[model samples]
Target: MSLSKLKLTTCLWFDGNAEEAANFYTSVFPNSKVLHIQRYLKNGQELHRQEPGSVMVVEFELDGHRFVGLNGGPNFKFNEAISFQIDCANQEEVDYYWAKLGEGGDPAKQQCSWVADRFGVSWQVVPTAMKDMLASEDKAAAGRAMEAMMHMKKLDIAELEKAFRG
Candidate 1:
């Protein structure tokens, strides 16, 4: 299969904190950076009604994935239906993301390695081994791992491995 030269980017809708969210995301993830920012101008104020120099959109990269954060007002909000999955290598990595992404968000939304960040974006800080364990040929072991995982918010790699072994 030939890869297309076109670069696909994910757009994150923000009420009025596109730049803040972009900065937070860049800080949390390594190899990430804010690329560009577009501001609202005077001529377009009639439609947007935003301050002339206010942020309109912030283009950023988080761990090599490109994303655009749009300051599209509060007309829309993020829900649990869609979320980004972060593949973590170990318990420490999972903990790091859980704390970083889950901070200042709705605590009630956290469940089974899934969390909503302060900006209302959902993320699943999942351990890479969890996928392999859940896909094991042994039905009983896989079931045990799933059962164990379902009970935890921030995933524990050792506990998951133990469940897989059982």
Candidate 2:
């Protein structure tokens, strides 16, 4: 049987730091690298604007996923409507990402999720089993789990499980 896989690539647009952001991401994730780099040419003449050979486009892979970074100028900025969710297995994982990504950014609390990072990207660092526990058949159990999650900035799986079982 042939199965069709849905492959989605996220394209990130930056004012002029697409290359910088790609490098930063590759450093943070394992099995990541800058596959290709391109520079912009204007009428057969390389523009000596800003940094020479500054990243026009960067093709990179992070954790086996492909992403394209476009230095499409600063016409747009990232908003909270679209965010990345990081499913963590434990508090250690949560703390590590929270600290690293939250550098030079503001933190906004939303249950077990927060918005941080210098790029103004929002990340939801949640426990791995949070969704399963939250979707329990028992309404009271699920409610309890949600209640616990709502009070936390970083998800605690142990506490969520406790609430689910109680």
TM-score of each: 0.95, 0.82
Per-prediction RMSD in angstroms? 1.8, 3.5
List the pairs of residues colliding in candidate 2. Answer: none
Off by over 4 Å in 2: 1-6, 44-52, 109-111
Candidate 1 lowest-lDDT run of ten: 44-53
Looking at model 2, residue 47 earns an lDDT score of: 45
For model 1, the superposed segments whose C-alpha errors exceed 4 Å read 1-4
> What is the C-alpha lDDT profile of model 1 across 8-75, one tens digit per residue?
99998999999999999999999999999999899978788788899999999998899999998989
lDDT of 2 by residue, 98-154 (tens): 777777767653436675667766777776777777777888998999898888776
lDDT (0 to 1) per candidate: 0.94, 0.77
In model 1, what are the clashing residue pairs, if there are any? none
Model 2, global lDDT: 0.77
Candidate number of the best TM-score: 1
